[model samples]
Target: MLEIEQFLHWQRAIGRSQNTVRSYARHLSQFYRWLAARGIVWDELDFRQLCDFVAVLTAGLPPLPSRCGGRAPGTVKAVSAAVREFYEFHRVEGRGPQDLVLTRNPSKLPRRAHSFLAHLEHRRPREVSRLARPDRQSAETVQVIDFETDFAKLLAAASTTRDRLLLSAQYDLGLRVGQALGLRHGDLNPMRRQVMIRRRDDNANGALSKQKTQFIVEAPRRFFDLYAAYLLGEIAHVDSDYVFVNLSRPPVGGPMTYSNAYQLIERIGAAAGIDDLNPHMLRHTHATALAKAGWTAAEIAARLGQSHSASADVYIHLASDDLAEKLRTTEHLVWREPQQYRLKGDGDGAR
Candidate 1:
């Protein structure tokens, strides 16, 4: 068996992230078990034997292994890396030869491709009508209105009207969970009908305007009205700063945590008969709504603070109704016959 201390030492020396090192250690330990099951010592196993072990690890079993089943080539590569690192450490320390760690090119292995198209079809099929299964998330139409209504319900159920405004801000502005929770009082501009999102790190305020970039989300008039009510109502000791507050009437704490936002969504979704409601779903609904309203993927990406619109492609599937309408419009433009007129030379000269 490989020495655990040496493996961890090598991982730390290589400057790997804590999460990554933990994952690598787990995969290598699993590899050790598979080797032992076949009565082979890891150090004594040849390169060909290692390949066989990998094949066995990936092959379909009756019940399938936990977390390891259906692992992609990338996962296989990760395991191989951990094994190689362990052997290499031994070799460099003079306990084994350098050749013991077989170095094979990972790119040569068969790659596993995840088809987003198939995922979309299975999750929300375009052929299915919305009315047939209104509860089912369908690609036939973007579910923006459903999201809006559910968000409204969440606000009403909130412990305070401020919480309600915060929920409204997320759906209305398409703010990410982090951005929504990090909002400050200065962020909201009622007259401008916009909010500014300042980025933070480590659940604490980092450098002001250092890692900070501002994003503007269109605040509906209702948001302004709600904010006014929240400020004027029972919330005593109201702080001039911080748009969102904790349960306390006077804002003793800063903005809400991201976890609180997630729990709020879960609670609200359960109340709205949408058990799977999530922040990203609201973002998806926003993207789908924009796409249907003739916004390009790039525009949607910019508004959502994404470096690329590739992630926004999932919402494109939700624009099936818009696509169908566009096709109907195209039919009239291209296939319809035009009225014919006889020229002067066809029958008689112009009078």
Candidate 2:
């Protein structure tokens, strides 16, 4: 317990966020409990015992009768990773034996590295997960919400106009939830038909754009129409600079928090009968739409504010149907923005 506390403290000192620290602490705690029950020494844990622990996690059987649910595959992987880190930390501090051995795979060399830090990252031996099984997923198997069916249902199920805008904000422009929540009144440019994504650190609701620089998002005409309707119906008298604010809640004019946004998405998904949907799915759907429309990797990266074009390959490489092509045939958008403005085309792409 004390070792975990020290590790968490060091993690915080090294500038890890509170959420990340909590996750590491929880993961390490669960691992320690497992070790204690088996009368296993923390540092003396061998590979075979580690594998058995992972097997127990994979079984999703509750270790204690009071516990109700089983751990997901992702959770199993996370817990094992924490255990490995815990032992490594203790060993490095001269408190335990060098039990967690990391061997070079040589196969995972820089030959296949493509992204900015990919080569530098693979310069050393990668952490081969001996505990959890490999999560084998193909590049062509990307799951995204269908705009015409699932996404449309999600929009119609939303109770308020603001909620519809929130869904559209993510799907239409691939705006991150934080960026959508961080939106201010000044960010919306009705004349230019753009939304400025500014990176701010001082939002009262703690919402922030993930990017370091401000970028303009070209929004559809329907997006702006919804915004106008929302402003008139909900926050007509409310005095807040934030575009999306609490209309029915106690904080009458305050900006919507991340918790509020997440719950809204969950509720909308359930109402639309969408299985296990999350907010990021909308962003993925948007990127997949672009990729299906034959947008280049550089173009998708710029649109999504990703660090590199190689990162967009996953969306482009998917073996999807002609959904984007079909959607584009019906959709219409004008090229309009203040600084990022371009000459008008035939009005086919998302503005």
Candidate 3:
């Protein structure tokens, strides 16, 4: 347990973001708890034990009713990576045996291998079959909503200007909830029609971008209008720099936490008759709109502030019907025959 704290501190020292460190801590804690339950000692941990743990995470072995079913493969991978890192740290400190092995391939040896035999050895970490696991997340489970109509319902259901703007940021700017809530007053630029997502260490509510990099995203004009209203009405007397603040009784001026943001969405969703609505769904809605509107993958990725197009691929897949429609239009324009050139047997086609 003490080593977990040390590992977290080391992660911070290496400049990992707070959210990442917290995730690592959580993963390691779960692994350690599982080990303890089985009366397994740390020093006795081996590759087989690690494999068993992975099975538990990927298959929900030794089923516990209170526990949710197996986690997604991506989550299982994260847990495995954390455990591997923990082992590496312990091995480096001479507190645990090496879990990885080194092997040499004589057939693929470099020309200089004879002079440097040690360099020929390649490090091979313990095996975990990533291919055998299920997808990190099931695309079919993603709930997409009718953006314009549902958004209007959300706006109508919002109790305050702040809540409305929160939804606007998520839906309009395609921001993750953390990115939206992390917004400070200065992050918004009405004149430039952009909102900056900057990395901050003091966000107690864990409002940080997944990429942990500062970037600006285009803001809807209406969102800026709401921002102006929120500043003057809801935030006028508040002293906090955070754009969103708690409106309910105690700690009214405090920064809005993630729970507060989620509850607001859930309440509005119920009123709007949209089941299981979430901030990420709004983001997906934005991405889907972009893909259907003929935006390039790179353009959509840039707008979403993603480092790569892979995350944007899901939206592209969701817009398959739109893509098919475009393809049909293209086919008609390039390959459709003139009406005057119909076959004699095709009576309906010969007009």
Candidate 4:
């Protein structure tokens, strides 16, 4: 019999998230139960058996709605990771046969070009997706001005300045919701007019850094003043508390929920006559705007916490001056001027 409890203990000790640990536990339990039904023990498992297990999971089953809804990519990946980790853990412990192996690939389903966007449209509780179909031969084009105008309206119409600030931070500063919510009173240096986003302390619960690296975001004078005044209110609590919180008399901390933050954006969009504006779209706008403003792709990627690799090229392409710079930087030989250091008017070099 496999000692599942011992493995779970080790996982918790390793500082995995509560949700992650719970998910791993659930997946391993299901796997163990399935193996039990077949009268097979973990020690006796092999790669072939593991492959069969994945095949069974991939087999077309009756479509039933789950809490996560029908078969999500994230859920599938998590389950697969749990199973692989379990076997790998046993192998490392020297208790199970080394023959046991699980494929790391989660989506055995056939690749579909727009499946993810479709899933987002259909499965997501609140959001709607609309992907445009363009001619393959014609160059793909996006109306950046439209995106900016719509997003700016959304930010302006926010019910509270805090909500406006949140949107502004996402669009202007390129911060994730977690990072935004994680901001603290002390993080803002009004004297210097710069916000330091080092380690986030969201609430009494506390939050850990998602990227592990601390960065600073420069705010405009008006934004800094709004933040300063917001801090001065009786609603503001301790110096370590989150900057944005419920506007209660006592000032309940721990930051707002992710859903509330999203709903705030959506609500603002509705008010601003913009149908859809998401947090991620704001992030995209931030990156695209920076690129358009002649900022290097590397700089955008660093600020956006993105990988400095191939996709960086997209930012480069998005840059406004790329074409102009390329043309200007090309060098051409005006004249040969050879033949023993010839004078300004040589036969070969004369205009």
Q: On residues 1-351, what C-alpha lDDT tens digit does candidate 4 reach at each position?
A: 337877787787886644356668878876776687667777888767765555444442322124333443434445666887776677788867776544323244334477656855754232111111122222432223244677667757876667767876777777766677777777878888777766443244333445557877777676776675566653455444677676642435546655567777777877887655556557667777777676777787777666564555443335456566645655334344455876666677645
Each model's lDDT comes to 0.62, 0.76, 0.77, 0.62
Query: In model 1, what is the error at residue 89, expressed in angstroms?
Result: 15
Error of 2 at 282 (Å): 1.0
How far does residue 60 in candidate 2 sit from its true spot (Å)? 2.2
Root-mean-square deviation of every model: 11.4, 11.9, 8.5, 11.9
Better of 1 and 3 by TM-score: 3
Greater-TM-score candidate between 2 and 4: 2
- For 114-210, candidate 3 gives per-residue lDDT tens digits of 3456667774543433323332343243567887988999899888899899999988999988888888888888999989998787786767777
Question: Candidates 1 and 4: which is better by lDDT?
Answer: 1
Q: Give the per-residue Cα lDDT of candidate 3 at 77.
A: 67
Q: In candidate 2, residue 128 scores what lDDT?
A: 60
Clashing pairs in 3: none
TM-score of 3: 0.72
Q: In model 4, where do residues sit more than 4 Å from their true spots? A: 1-100, 104-147, 200-203, 232-240, 249-251, 257-278, 305-351
